[model samples]
Structures are given as structure tokens and as C-alpha cells.
Target: MSLRYFDNLLKSLYTVARMNEPAKPDWEKIAAMPEFQALLKAKRRFVVPCCIFFTIYYFSLLYLVGWHTEMVKKVVLGHLNIAYLFALSQFFMAWIIAFLYTKKSSKFDQQAAAFLDHAGFKK
Candidate 1:
């Protein structure tokens, strides 16, 4: 694709990023031997601690933001408020978690696919 098209696509994605909500997890995929459990266990080990830390961090931000919401509202950037940016930072954290998840899941998927192919389940 051309750079302009790619740029437009990226802009569209950014707009979607601002508007999009998180998805619901699939129980059927959890039920399948899709390596999600094992991968999930591995992911969970890292994620759990990170989540705890983030939960604390987030609440602390909430406290501070509440404390300084007025001051923050005054310090604006191109029509955006600090509170919205702070809230958006939380989404960025979630996005980071998701990116890590996708990378790790891709690794698990590669291994699982290889195993499945070797075991005569190639499809």
C-alpha cells in the first residue's frame, strides 16, 4: 500500500482506538485445547502482579487527579484535559497488556500449530 493510504489507515485506527471498547473473552476458546490455558497461566503470572501494581497506581492517580482536577483542567492541550489524558493513559496500559498478550499468544500459536501439524491434525 502507498504511504498516504497507510497513513489514512492509521488515522482510522487511531479514531477507532479512541472510540473502541474492550472485547469479551471467549469461553469456547477457553474450553478448547488451544494452548490458551497454558499460555494464559504463563501470561497470568506476569499479568497478575502487573495488574496489582497498576490497580494501586491507578487508584493513586485517581486520588491525585481528584485532588488536582481543577488545576489539571486549567493545564490544557489543544482542547484536551489532563484528566482525559490520564484516563487515556490507563487505556494505553491496557493496550500494552494486549500487545504483550498478542505476542505471547502468537508464540504459543506457532508452537501449537507445529505440534498439531506433526500430530496429523494439519489443516
Candidate 2:
């Protein structure tokens, strides 16, 4: 067969496949729900501040390393410089944030479940 015929066949198959899929949830209704709105608010309350804090922290480290190398070089430990400590602390900071987010997300999950239950969408 020709390339155009093969492309048309694929397009028709894709359309059929999409048509067979189940209906999606009504997001407008979900968004209007109080529980869903609260879940979104909770996420924003945690995430936005955390993101801003981390951005400032990461930039401050960059600024120190870039323009204040002499200060960062001062040894706080036996041989490790302040820069090294700060760099290592970034990893720990990420882990701590992730741990806190995990804890916070459990509450969001409950809120989501409640929304679904209220909406009669729970399976």
C-alpha cells in the first residue's frame, strides 16, 4: 500500500482507540468542591514557601562561592572549608524538605479521598 493509505489507517485506528476509552472525571466539578480547593490551598501553602526558601538558599550559596571565595575557604572543620559544608548541607536540606513534603502529602491525600467520596467518584 502507499504511505498516505498507511497513515490514514493509523489515524483511523487511533481515533477508534480513543473513542473506546472511559470517560474522565469532571474536573470543573472537582475544582469547585471545597475539599479539593482546600487540598490545593494546603499544597500551595507548603510548596510556595519551600520553593522560595530553597531558591534563596541556593542562590546565596552560589553568590558566596562566586564572589566571596576567600570567606568560604575558611576551614570550619579539620580540613573542610565552609563551602564544602554548605554544599553538603544542600543535600540534607533537600532530604529534609522531601521528608516534610511526604508527611504533608498524607494530609492532602486524605483531603483528596474525602473529596472523591463526597463527589461519589470513589470506586
Candidate 3:
């Protein structure tokens, strides 16, 4: 092949590689954005409370299981003790919280997308 053809091939490969790469966000601009700040605040508002509540719930359950054996052993259903129910409920609670967070985060994603588009970050 001619040198000219080789140069053209290299340029074409470089162009294709660059095209496939995602554009990097301007971190300085993103950090300075009011929308981004609001996103952080909104995320914290949901997450902080969730963390606090779950921490309390988990510790209380642990305490009850460790210190209140009689209370935890009391049958609530057909041979299902309070401890058993509480243990099982932890799985359900986790799933429910995860589902809720997924639902909530979609809204945040939408808002973030809009903000990015407004800031000329989206292609």
C-alpha cells in the first residue's frame, strides 16, 4: 500500500475509536451546577434517613434476639417464633427498600440527564 493509504487508514481508525468513546463530563462545571448540588441534597435527604432507620432497626433486632430470648421465642404463627418472623422480615424489608430506592433513583437519573443535556454534555 502507498504511504498516503496507510496515513488515511490510521486517521480512519483514530476517528472510529474516538467516536466509540463516551464524552467526559466537565467535572468543574458539574460540581458548580445548581442542579448537581440539588441532586446531592436530594440523594442525601433520602439516603441519610434510610441509613439511620435501618441502623436502628437492625440493632434493635439484634438486641432483642440477644437479650430478650423469651420475647423472641414467643410463637406468633403456627410454630413460627417472633425471632423467626423478625429474621424473615429483614429480607423483605431489604428487598422493599431496594425496590423503593430503584424507583426513586430513576427520577434522579432523569433529572441528571436533563441537567447534563442542558449543560451540553449529552450527545
Give me the candidate number with maximum lDDT.
2
Q: Model 3 over residues 1-123: C-alpha lDDT tens digits? A: 999999999999999999989887779987889988888899999889988888887888999999998999999899999998998988888888889999999999987887788777755
- lDDT by residue (tens digit), candidate 2, 1-64: 8999999999999999999999897889878888888888999999999999999988999999
**Candidate 2 backbone collisions, by pair:** none
Please provide the root mean square deviation of candidate 3 (C-alpha atoms, Å). Answer: 5.3
Q: Spell out the clash pairs found in candidate 1.
A: none
Clashes of 2: 0
* Per-prediction TM-score to the true structure, in the order listed: 0.43, 0.76, 0.73
Q: In model 1, which runs have C-alpha deviations exceeding 4 angstroms?
A: 1-45, 108-123
Alpha carbon lDDT of residue 36, candidate 1? 46
Give one digit per residue, the lDDT tens place, for model 1 in 3-39: 9999999999998997777575465754455454555
* Model 3 regions lying over 4 Å from their true place: 1-26
Candidate 2 residue 97 Cα shift, in angstroms, is: 0.4
List all candidate RMSDs to the true structure.
18.8, 4.9, 5.3
The global Cα lDDT (0 to 1) of model 3 is 0.89
Regarding lDDT, does 1 or 3 come out ahead?
3
- Tell me how far candidate 2 lies from the true structure as C-alpha RMSD in angstroms: 4.9
